[model samples]
Target: MAATETVAERPDYDPVALAESLASAADKSAKVLGDFIARQAAAGKSMVTDEFGLTQAFLELAAKMLSNPYRLAETQMNLWWEYSALWQSSMLKLMGQSTTPVVEPAKSDKRFRHEDWEEHFLFDYVKQSYLIAARWLHNTVANVEGLDEHTRRKVDFFTRQYIDALAPSNFALTNPEVFRETIASGGQNLVKGLNNLLDDIERGNGQLKISMTDSKAFELGVNIATTPGHVVFQNDLMQLIQYEPATAKVAKRPLLIMPPWINKYYILDLREKNSLIKWCVAQGLTVFVISWVNPDERHAAKDFVDYMLEGPLAALDAIEKVTGEKDANVLGYCLGGTLLAAALGHLAAKKDKRIVSASFMTSLIDFTGAGELEVFIDEEQVSSLERKMSERGYLEGSHMANTFNMLRSNDLIWSFVINNYLMGRDPFPFDLLHWNQDSTRMPAKMHS
Candidate 1:
């Protein structure tokens, strides 16, 4: 059993007023949604209708499909030639004559081409065909005329996702290794995989579970988060955990870690070998970490400002009290790093320097060339999301997780669908995958 630590309530938080405050915020969010949707509806005509350039792009692509079979025809003939040569080599090897394949996967495409795939000629063909199809489709879309840059990129991103999801490697019949395993085991793996699928469906309440965490394999602060620590302070937003000193005499300066509230803090202290907290302790550094609260009805009112003031800001004060040091080295990860930046600015503005040095991991500082999320940022989408957030008072964790998963849906989603359902295989147990699955809700105000 995991040890239970004592918790102390935060001095600044008011539990009684939380309900009233959240209701007011939710009402405001709803009003914003109404105004936003009205404005969007009032806008003259959509770009898709008004823009002739987009219409021309589609027409050109369709015209090429009919008139210019030469490029596609040449490509098809080359693939058939490669397949014929490979088939001949496979037959010779099977009949006791040794021969190497005529075609090999390219250097850049090595990740998709596994050694096991090359061992079997049929698997090799499937792998090569999949890669070839992807490349052809990508080039075809890239060369299409008149489409604007943004639309082209979005189309390309989703097309890759679709192609990848349809990869032969994901299915047992198309994958020689999985087929062989099914035959050797007399379909026992499939039976076990089916059971795994059923369990996941039941666990997720009928949704095909995409996460790769084997939830039964580990427990927080038991097998993981096992670094000796005491929960020294708690608030509506976070818990300040003070890890025990690993050395007889610790560093005069302490370390304060702030992980993103979107994820649980145990990611840094996953297991003994991988735990950053344990590694720091071994180096004779006293470390204190902030474990964020998963928002529900009670925490729906807390905004980013609330988090900065009561979260890391309060943790710094508590760390100072415990270690008798006014300043501590601070480190933050992702959104946590963003929050830390806000806290630092606040402290600097107030002329209080409690943070000595800072380290950040995967923090978003620049938005230029802002990446794939731009497609979902239009006024209509924001209004839709805001309306939902207004009703719930917090944006569902699944919403954020699904959005992130779309960036690589084939691997993050469909691959698992094939494995867990079609192949009947359970999710592979991995720490990083586990952390990703353990998502937390964001307050509506903070989400804004």
Candidate 2:
């Protein structure tokens, strides 16, 4: 009886219990939201005006925000303190501790300093001015009457737009493909306009080449030399291997190629017709490719430093050894390009002067302007991810793949979903798609 009583006295607060409660709440919320959306669809109503739609959108955004454990924890901690302080005083009074003074710590000493009074006063004045202006606008809108139907509609539209703009739901997860398509479409239009203007300018001087060159033209016209008898050198880097020509007779100078570790080097060497590598070779450029080793559990201990030293530097050494050239032009694509920039910076700091010209393709440096990835790279999100990766020793390749897929959900993920799942059509084979499918694993250190 004593043992049973002791067992029964165990604390009720448990992590599993909290998790279950959260899941149940989430399930209920999802069900409610689904039903609301279904009702709106049945009614053939747009999401713009209906109160339920607005409310649902806000809830959805909130849910998305909460999905990030780090943000969720921070928010929860803040709310906890706010509510705790509110109730703490009452509880203390009820427990006969009211006579004891509750000393609240100062958040900032500057708030009390006399010198900062003017600054605080100015801030208060600006805040109050904004509040007064907002109230005036609200009152004016509420009192408006006898307006024409067109004017009323315009007002309604503006009001809805303002509310929607302020709604948190508007910031929820959006399809990346849609965003990319929009941007690309705009870019293409701009390019077309620019080209037309350029063509007009060139027409006055001579004949203008208005046509775009196909991949075949690049292969045949370029004079780098990829004939049958040409010898290409190969070197092994653990499980991976790199290939480059033994001698570049046509090339004026040696060129070093840095491919992203996320994908294989074969993208630049797909086939004779569409091979960028072959094109460069035909253009008289001495070329070398960096082949990244596919990582496994055993390679989890490797980090960014190891990749910097071994990957590009090793390729550089091989290029110099084969071509007898001390310096070479370096080109990097995407993540590889970013790594190359970092490596270059590191080398520059150390006063190393082996690199000549450097070129980057679709590579990100400053993340401040990163369009969609910001949703995933906030401090809270990264911290939560770090915790998970800490347990696994390394982040899995699938995780990185999923992130990229999410960035272009409409095109990379959902467009396929519609075609393959909804329409019941097989995926069409395209060279770009083929390359995308041939993704390589990122080493633990490089990934981190």
Candidate 3:
């Protein structure tokens, strides 16, 4: 038999007192720290002049401190305290237990033992103050509107410094690895998953299987005399099919299909089911595709100017000559698009009006916000590439392919790595992969 014991009711917990005390302590700490920094700045003419080394030292110290488990734990604890204080005060006020709380203070841990934090704090305050000062200075100069050359140059220098300092990457030295790790981890997972799915699809669809009969039949067809209209134009840079109309009648205007040099042109004519070129021909548009010359060591000396003259422009001339159309509809894709834009600019400068209408697919004209490509396009990287191209007659097709592959490594390289090395399986046959493997070389001058 169990004796029934009466349980005493537990008292309700009130976080209001704790929240108020924390809020007061944080406010006092912030004021004291702010005052101390003010005094330090007042003593020194400028934060940058007085404590640049200290600032750098603090940054290094912060990196080392964050790497330590105990220091990280302390940071977390302090952050939690600040967050809890804010949360409790908000909740208490909502529950009518207390008034709204003051804003929580910035979480700084002295226990981490770094002189840099104080220096960093002072530096930031001074930098911000200088920015405000610079802005006023700029406005004053602008209002004067007749500053001397030297004075204008000084103003410009200050403006540049102020703007450059505001750049997000300037403070990136503080927590760079954190951002990098976050980006790399997410990108790796996404690419790995996508590649696995692609591999699975390739396996299920039996895309890799090449039947002997099919191979024999395709080879036989290639050898046999086909219709004169079925012309597969092959060169060092490009491969394209030129479809001529059976009848004497042809389209009034000929349209040239341009694809990104980064990838083969076959994406535009994947199959009979979804062939843009076939559809255009059927719709009374004379279609011609410019297969780029796959470059090799022999073509390394080529440059951008050479590509403009020989690649799209050559195709345009050939198309006009073949079809006898004075004006042609020019279509460009990606890099091809960029080349076309440049050609158009060159033509516009010369007032050349042979082109009727220009269409660009996923093409960029202005280099602003080019995103990830910017990392590889800086002076140092471009210079190195130029040097390599100069040494070699042409840029290797494999090198170009590798660069593109690195841009999306998880999908391009890692998937194959996992399938071939980890899973011990052969690469699944994909049209895109097939085209990717069929890379073309760039003339050295063109590539540079």
Candidate 4:
């Protein structure tokens, strides 16, 4: 106590560094504002569309809830009971007494994986409180009757999205890990996080395009898509890649792969250990893959019929020309599978047996169980999207990427929000995420 400590030994040291970081953050924030203003100005003359139609849907939801006051009362009563129990449990924990959580996160939920979420009393309380409220909200909306199926699904989907956005782990003040990082870094984490947020907004032209991976760490043909292949055929729709044979002798009929045009083909050939294209070639089969064009306004009029005619059908013709085989085995994935089914039907009608065998991977022939995606399929939303697409000639790849991210909002969207923005950490380089973030535009007719 008698000895005076130096400024270096003080816990609150380095005012200059902190001030510099804050100054840099302020500069970046100002730049962000300028960019946003420029974006709005550039879009001044563009027509605006209600892309989601969330307003009318929510109005109907509110109207239904008000019409059924007794149901609402019952739901509120149940929520109150849960909250009372949670309060009691939280008090017992505060007094160092054994207590059980009112609700636990799903086993697969990674947002609350930190030990502090369970070990720290306040964090535990926040987590359980949020879980209970979320459960009650989901159950109430899901049980809502009188609303049509599409409207009900839309309401339920968007409600979950709202709840996911409000999770404690997403906010630095509420997230224990982020909070600790903020304190340890003397709020520099926050300053850097601001810079990150501004960078993403600028990258998206004022929209928030979350960075999912270290994009610069990968390239198309260097580290990934490294399987030896050549563009044997190309047309307006796609480029057909023929991989070098791994064996002296190959299969009599080549294997033609039709990857989804909604994404690039490199997913199957991401790396050596996991490359499906390489694996197929090793099995003594000639592999042919369709790499769809990342279309632009020039391809606005290209339809599904054009895709079938020019995609798989054209590939089959080109394969015969190269390998001297009239028939070949075909495989399709996702949207490609849908196209394959249509092409098969078309060929069957023409009595064309060029396709000797067919395989489908995660294809959707029926829309009955379209799950959360059905939220975007209603007529109003579709029309709104079409209007937007008509002007641009194609739907932006990022728009579809964002839609898919919303399906797993906590995992794909909010988790990154916490790590990359709140915690001020760069996203780690990951192959699958790189692929996920490497989105391709969907042609207007094909997408619709």
Candidate 5:
């Protein structure tokens, strides 16, 4: 009888409190629904269908698996054998015997960090069961015989997303910490969690934008981007910021930095102690950084060639005018580096030699080994994006941020979901995250 008793049967459990919390949660849930309905009615936006072409990719994967029955059978048999081992191990653990977990999470996986995940028998079983299934799914999909490279990559990427979403840690009932919190708080946490979800969806204009950190925690040119600088010149496209000289003797060649327009330039000058801009000033070099315009429809016609002619090329002419320096050392980061490389080729063609030295940071000159980002770079997807951009005049900043976030969904996306929506907690203030969420728009012509 004692063995059969559950946690709810214990003296500490209060049914009355649980009932009250549930009632409150139901009221809040109605408010959530009503707000959602009103927002939809106001916007009257239509649903976008399969913008990523995931359906076609999955169908192809299914066809390949169906044609290779033997391979599928072998993979299924392997999974069954693993499940059997896990059952035996779990049985031993339930009998108060020491047994090894059939599978362990990777060292970097933080979902299973709570002590209850290991200390409690039921949760330990759930964790191992989920891990085993996740491994089997990944291996099976990865080994599918005859899919093209692009289709295979898309399948694998989405497969990881599917598994990550279904992880036991994500759901409250299966997550020991959340379960304990629910019981202790009599489900008030859940009511709060629902409120947080509604607030976030409303903030995103009917889309869910999970808050990674407190949005009000930082400001431009204050706590961040605090390096002393003067806007020495401005073109229609960018502002040339010249930092105040830190030393009496300045270097003969000024240092000009061209940052990627995909993000704001303040990323390089985030804070004083670690700011590259500040360090350059202290190095006795007159530094000039290009702050790209946060473009809108008016600037939609600006293309890559326009960016080159008006961006670094224009900055070069401005730098020469400001500091009496005819030649300057140029550095570009990421997309900025790509643009600089193109400008070099253009200048070479015209026999111009205003740049003395050039440096690139995480810049790509070749596309053959573009890594995981290649999954979204095919002609079909590019054309689809072009059509979308034509409607908006530019790629939305949030869309670009969402794409980058998908690359590390577990870290950037799901973790916050559990913390902010499942646990009913406010995100901690983080400067780096603040910077990341402060995304900038990309002009349609330049982006295309």
Candidate 6:
């Protein structure tokens, strides 16, 4: 009867209400877009009027580029003629003829390494042509005028993304290694690759198959995260895991690791040898880690503020209770680090500084130079994302993983496509790759 009453007391979610709310938000987003564009137009007028910021910006760009314009052009021209010879020779090979050899670039650029790539008449031509085009595009962008520093940085970042996407290695036909593999495998590889492709398509539900990690080969807290730990505390957001002390004498300052909620906490305790948690235990420090909950619709309404309160703050409270230590050192990784920073700020504001020291690993405090990600971050794009999230209630881990894979399409996306789809090869079991594949969902409100 108690259980039944508890179940009945639970909040009743209304899909219709959610849809109406989303429609209203969409309407609001359109207004925001209009206001944003108007504000930009108004501020842009000041660039021409009050400060001449645009003129100054261009003048600075001009000074940076035109300092050695003549020498730059001459060097470019010479480089072009040199590559032209390679192209001419390659064209001869294509037409069933032969031509004399010419000097090639030393290629301190390590990415061009393919055994006898220069000797292969077809690949050599394709490779050198790509290099020349890439260099020209990069240099042209480097010298472009009329962009302010921030705008110029975004342009440069996106330009690099485009150039990387254009790399010959990304394509099955252009890549020399893939071509060799195709021959060596005698087309059986294509069959295997097709099978892999079909399997992913059949299972993936419209998501790209990135990692080929065999999930059955690994189990949590047994083979992978084998370090000894028990859940001492848990809240709506996460579980506070306190690892057993390895040394007889441990440090008074307990270490608490806060990994990004986007991934599992066991990344720190991946393997016994490579596990940072195990290493810290050996170093005679009491270690604690936060294993964030894989939230569903029940947590959809939770926001960043909720994460700050229930995540690190709750963990800190639990750590103090478990260890009887008022002060402890903290390590925050990536997105977790960002959350830690916000949480620390809030705690400090409230005069409750329990964390003695803090460490941030590869975290962002500012997005002044945020790379190609800027391309999809305009008002319209965000609104579209929110609408999608509103329908789902939360961002699926697969969806999040897809967006990240788009950031490095060549390595994370196409490499697998070539290996599993074109060459029909199986991927080896890599622990890191497995962790990467194991993504965690985020609440829509928090993610936004």
Q: By summed lDDT, which 10 consecutive residues of candidate 2 come out lowest? A: 167-176
Specify the poorest-scoring 10-residue window by lDDT in model 6: 45-54
Per-residue C-alpha lDDT of model 4 across residues 102-203, encoded as one tens digit per residue: 899999999898999999999999999999999999999888779998889888999999999988998988899998888777787887788888889888
Model 2 scores a C-alpha lDDT of 0.52
Q: Can you write out model 2's per-residue Cα lDDT over 1-448, one digit (the tens) per residue?
A: 9999966765444456545644654565465556656766875656564311234334444454455667556555755554455356535555655422122213452122232222233332322233333333443443344444433433433443353233211221122222233253432322333333333224323222221112132331232223332324443332222334444456646777777877766677766687777677777676677767667666677777777777777767766776678888888888779879988998899998889889998888786677545445444556656654555456655566666765544356544433332222345645555555545565445555
Best candidate per lDDT, number?
4
lDDT of 3 by residue, 78-115 (tens): 55564566456545644656443333112441111233
- Sorted by TM-score (best first), the order is 4, 5, 1, 6, 3, 2
lDDT, each prediction: 0.73, 0.52, 0.53, 0.90, 0.88, 0.74
Q: Give the RMSD in angstroms, all C-alphas superposed, for model 5.
A: 3.3
Where in model 4 is the C-alpha error above 4 Å? 1-13, 45-49
Error of 3 at 197 (Å): 20
Worst 10 residues of 4 by lDDT: 1-10
* TM-score, structure 2 vs. true: 0.48
- Candidate 6 lDDT for residue 311: 86
Q: Return the candidate ranking by lDDT, descending.
A: 4, 5, 6, 1, 3, 2
Angstrom error at residue 74, model 4 = 2.4
For every candidate, C-alpha RMSD to the true structure in Å: 15.2, 26.1, 20.2, 2.6, 3.3, 16.4
Q: List the residue pairs that clash in candidate 5.
A: none
Q: Which ten residues in a row have the lowest lDDT in candidate 1?
A: 1-10
lDDT per residue for candidate 6 within 188-265, as digits (tens), equals 455556556655653554333554666567788778999998999998899998899999999998998999999888
> Model 4 lDDT vs. the true structure?
0.90
Candidate 1 per-residue lDDT, tens place, 68-183, comes to: 67766766686677667766777786676778656455666423445668766567667766766667677766665556676666556656766776778678788665676666
